[model samples]
Target: MTSQTLLSHVASILDAAGVKRGAIHDVHTNTHLLRHEVTTNLDATVYRPLFCLILQGAKEVGTSAKLLKVRAGQSLIVSHALPVVSRITEASPDRPYIALVFPLDLDLLRSLAPAVMPTFDKAASDPFSIFRRDMDEGLEDALLRYFVQCKAKNTRHLLAPITAREIHARLLIGRHADVLLRLLWHDSAASRINEATREIQSNLSETIVVGDLAQRIGMSSSAFFEQFKAITGTSPLQYQKDLRLLRARDALRATRAKVSDIALRVGYESSAQFSREYSRKFGKSPRQDRNIAPVEQQQCIADPAPR
Candidate 1:
């Protein structure tokens, strides 16, 4: 099928699914729909390993130095958990920005790795986690079939998983195959950084020792620090800080806990320090942010899926 035709099918599925003007979680596991009627300010969030296909409109996603514009007929693959700022760049009430996201299943990818034909030489340097490429007919067709099965009542359960696997297989052999392959290899930079991030996430409430983490990942401190920053666009400490603040924000919105209690819960020794950094990262103090309804604040941040 052509790119335009594939997009049409996806747009139809999104309309039938009835996603709202913001991010909506789909019934299928690890799938989400994003829609917006107007352009939005840059919103910070941790984009986990996922594939994002834009069916209509466009979006800009970036970190400190890297920015990617993903438009209709294009796809973006994020192979690791990275914090990014993203915004809808084009949209209208009549034709809203529409996109679909599916979190990558690493185990499934690994299971299919041996069967994948090697199509590229190993790169001397690791590529960034985020990749944008033209949507191929094979990938597009797989995505269309996935969405079609998603809408079907009786066939969805059996067919969706099969289609999801095909989509992954297509990506495994696509343009960013090397990056995805490196992520699966034990000694590759992407794999090591991914492991480190998971360790930090698992112990967010405790102190993180960069040297120890590097040692655990089988790299010198300097090497690990450099590669981690290169892949994630932030230092390890800064990444952990971002996660802590995000968790605190979620806590403030979800519970009646005091700001100080939340701060301590997320490993901040000083509540004053927490409030200062929280305001710097998010635009308002914790109390002020929490006063706003959860739905209103939801669009400003990205929630990382549990490891």
Candidate 2:
């Protein structure tokens, strides 16, 4: 199918699904429909391992190390959780930017690993955790089927999982196969970095010992630190700090907790320090940000559009 035809199909599904002007969680677990009528400022957020397909317009996403521009007919794959800054570069009411995102199922990917092992070079260098590629017909077909299944209440439960798996399979065998394989392979740089990320996430409020984390993940401290930064585009401590502040921001918006209490809960011992860091990261003090309307705060939290 032509790119425009495929986009038309996706647009129809999005319109029927009534996705609003922001991230709208769809019926399928881990799936979201993102739409925006105007360009957006660069926003920071943790992008979990997922695939994003842009149907119209364009977006820019970047870490401290690299920037990626993903437009229509292109797909962006994030192989690991990473904090990123992104913004919408193109959009309008006439043809607002629309995209679909779904989390990667690592366990499922692992289950399919054995069969696909021979197709990849075992010693290939790891690709960036976040990368973009042109969408292929097979992947597009899988996504189209998945989108259709998402809207079919009766068949969704039965078919969505199957189609989701197929989508991952297509990715594994397609142009991104090298990146996906390295990520899924045990003891690889991507997997080790992913482990470290999980450790930090689980202990967000606690002090993270980078050396201990490195040892636990079977890497020397120096090697682990380098790989962690390579994959995540930030140091281990910085990653943990970002997660803490982001969680604090979420708490500040969702509840009436005091700023100091929220700061303490997120591992910050001093409210004053927390406020300074939060303001620097988000361009607003905790209290000032909390004062914004909830809807506006949510908009601030939306995923950055790919560059």
Candidate 3:
């Protein structure tokens, strides 16, 4: 089946199954299903691991210095914890956005990548793991079957994990396999930066000394800095800033605490500095941004919303 045909099929299934389209939180497990229009643009939380595939409509994810646009038939994968800003660029009451996200099972990816003849980008310039396009019919077919099986309450526990493996396996052989492969290895610069990226995430609320992180990763400071940019497309320090701001935003949403208090919690000694950076990243200051709103009401700040 063509990508368009598969997408139409998935949409029909979701509509018939009565998938509730809306912003979801605390709806745990490895995957989520939905149908609806959302407001107050949602920034995807740092997924210790995440895979997002859109069956209808589109969304954009900003990571470091990279902004990836994923639409129907294309998927985005984040192997390491990365701060990302995501928005639904295309959707409506009649034609809503449909997506599936599976958290990374490192053990499974590591186990499978070595045996497969996956493609790797020979060009060292591209540093993202996103498979923005080129999702073939086979991959889409596997995903459709996986999501269908996932909705069965009784079989999910026993079968979801098995199917998740197949999803990753298909991803490895697909067009974006090289980027995913880079994420799994440790010898490459991208892999090293991924390792460093993890360390930053674990201690987002604490002070990060970049030099120490470089040393810990067994690379000299300059070499580490250069390689970090080469792989992730952002400096190590800027990466940390993104992590800190995202954490503060989460806290503000979930609690009634003062903005300054949230700032201090995320390692900003100066509330003014935190607010300044926060405004630059999210396009709203901490105080102004905190005006609580429903998930469906907010739109992304990067690209204008589609009417």
Candidate 4:
């Protein structure tokens, strides 16, 4: 089927299931279905590696430095964890915004790397960990079949994995091939920066010394600083700061922990400073109710909603 036809089918699936607003997790496929009925204000969250396919409407997703507009029939690939702000740019009761969110398994992508033909792509010159492009027919078809598989209890576990593998394999050979290929290559700068990101995420509250991270990743301070920003689109220190505030925001919404304690948990020794930063990021006080915050795993800060 054409991409348009597949998108409409996916829309029908979500509409019939009554997911006309916000997001719902798909237990079987381990993905999230997102929908919105109207345009929205900016929402912030940290995005992990995932695939997001927009079936209807459009959105504006941005990090500190990059802003991308994605619409229906386009797919977005987030290759690393990054904090982002986003707004739904187009939606209405008659034609809502709809999309699918599937987490990407870097290890699985790594395991499949050796099977592909190699190429020379400069990871340093590549400035983004998030990419958006048209959803090709093959990928859309595989995704549609994967959704269909999830509908049958028997095929959910059995055939879904096979189709999931097929989808990743298709991504490996698709337009995203270069960036994905670079990130998976063991000694590439993209891989090294990927390592750095994991270390930062592992301890968001802990103080990060860029020099130490550079040494740990086998690059000098200057080289690491430049390449890390090149690949991830933000400085190392800023990346850690953004992630810390995002995690703290999640804690604020999900728990009754005191705001000061949440700040300490995310590595801030000064509660006042943490509160100030949180307000700047989310445009609300740390103590405010986060009824509008996106769900934890939905991580679709990229797919926003009206609030």
Candidate 5:
């Protein structure tokens, strides 16, 4: 509700936690804190299911075809795994950009779906899987309370999960309910697109046959293609390509595997081709990225705490 009070509370916790820039994983709260002292350049990464609450400043995030901006007191929900290009458009030492990312648990949300009354729309008319708007006051209050409760050791374990459940329940009944409820249904376009994304994710190395995929999912190729782009903002092939490159980047950052080997692991037939696409996507060659991988490992991404 009152943005200033909540913002100040979040800022203080981040300050005490020593988050100067980049992202901080709050193990105690199972959330992440991101701060930037100045605006930044265009960056790319894969986003998972999560909601980011912008507490201060602003940022622009988008896929190849869509862009959305978030300022203080706003929130963004990413409902699927997406490769996104983003930039920090607002920040400074005195008023650093701050945001909190909380991962969405589909299983938990699915469980709560039965209790939630259905919306009139079969699926959200808005085809895109991402949503951004002014923060919901009730949701904001619940999150702030969750944060406060995490500070006390006794309640962090005993009561925090209850609040976490409340947070999901609020999402079901809140303004975010439409898109989420769409995903909850087994046969909605959004849900089908979500299934398609998982298939691609599970077999990144295997070549995709769009028609086969469409048939497997019970949709015609033309229909699948159109709905896929509508929901994901990228073509099916492009989605797989982006995901492969992102996974390769993660490998470059965390391992000493040969660049060519890493490329092959991600389904690239030619190491040279992989390098070219990698350079284009990330502005650096594979070896070059590996050279700077150590420092590059930490940033605002879908899953900071990767499995």
Candidate 6:
């Protein structure tokens, strides 16, 4: 088959297999977005650590101040947790937007780095933050085949990790290596900020002391705040709040618990406060919006227009 024909086949395989919209998969293959245009606004529960490949159409993702646009053949990567506003900018009835998200694995990056030639610029080091790029045909083909393999249970057991490695290798040589390479550097701000981010992500309900996290990452309060913003595109406090809101969203959908209880569980001292923030973040109160939308919609919200 021709290359374009192969890509089309891969897209078909993925759409035929996975959940329609917002669904989760195992470590191997998690989510897929079939070609479609959406008009509604939505929020997601889980903050996906993945890359979004847009086969067609356009999307916009926004945070408090940052708005990014992703167009056809391009993709956006969100490296950190964020409260976002996303809107579909391009789609039609005939040719809906086709997108795929590949989850990132820190462990895999560490494992594969030794085998690949280092092509990073140490002097231009920056923290691994969110990134955007246009995918080449080869990378797109690899991703399509990876998803197709993932759809087959038998093949996924053996090929998922291998295909995942190929994806990462392509990323290293693709347009946004600096952001990811910085994520792995020991002394880079991105690495420290990511380390701090992990601590907050795991402890979303706790009252985080940015100073303590700064100390843990060996950065002073001032330096830590600056580095954190540099890597994550937002302040540490905002990051914590975003994590709490996301967990609260999960709680909203997964259980029959009260909204107040869910809010408190996600670190809100007052239900009223949580509702207000949730409304601001999602454009609707937590009580008003009960269901989680597709993962793509939720993820793209943080970046509204693709950058």
How many clashes in each candidate? Answer: 0, 6, 11, 2, 0, 17
Q: Cα RMSD (Å) per model? A: 2.6, 3.7, 5.8, 3.8, 2.2, 4.6
Tens-digit lDDT track for model 1 on 1-307? 4656655765655577675467756665446777788888776667778888888899998686788899987888888777677888999998788887877888889898877635445573646788888888888878777877877766688888888888888888886687788788766788889999989888888998999999998999999999888888789999899889978987887899999999999999999999999999889999999865432134322235544
Alpha-carbon shift of residue 261 in model 2 (angstroms): 0.8
TM per candidate:
0.91, 0.90, 0.79, 0.91, 0.94, 0.82
Task: Summarize candidate 4's per-residue lDDT along 1-307 as a digit string, tens digits.
Answer: 4656656766766677787778876677777777888998777777777888888899988775888999988888887777777788999998888888887777788788888846636533455788888988888889889888887889998999999999899898987777777778888887788889988888778899999999999999999999888777789989998888877877877888898888999999999998888888777888774555563344453323110
User: Per-residue lDDT tens digits of candidate 2, residues 1-307?
Assistant: 6566657765665677675467666555456667888898877777877888888889998686678899988988888777788888899999898877767777788889879977776566645788788999888887777766766676688997899899888888998888888888886788778877877877789998888888999999999888788777788998888888877878888899999999999999999999999999989999999856432133222243211
lDDT of each: 0.79, 0.78, 0.66, 0.79, 0.83, 0.66
Candidate ranking (lDDT, best to worst): 5, 4, 1, 2, 6, 3
Candidate 3 residues lying further than 4 Å off, grouped into runs, are: 1-21, 25-29, 34-48, 117-125, 294-307
Over 4 Å off in model 2, which ranges? 16-20, 28-30, 122-126, 293-307
Cα lDDT for residue 124, model 1?
Answer: 35
Off by over 4 Å in 1: 5-20, 28-30, 117-120, 124-126, 293-307
Backbone clash tally (model 3): 11
Model 5 lDDT per residue over 168-214, tens place: 89988888887788877888888888898889998999999999999
Q: Which runs of model 6 end up more than 4 angstroms from their true locations?
A: 1-3, 14-31, 39-46, 115-118, 123-128, 148-160, 291-307
How far does residue 38 in candidate 1 sit from its true spot (Å)?
A: 0.4
Evaluated with lDDT, which candidate comes out highest?
A: 5
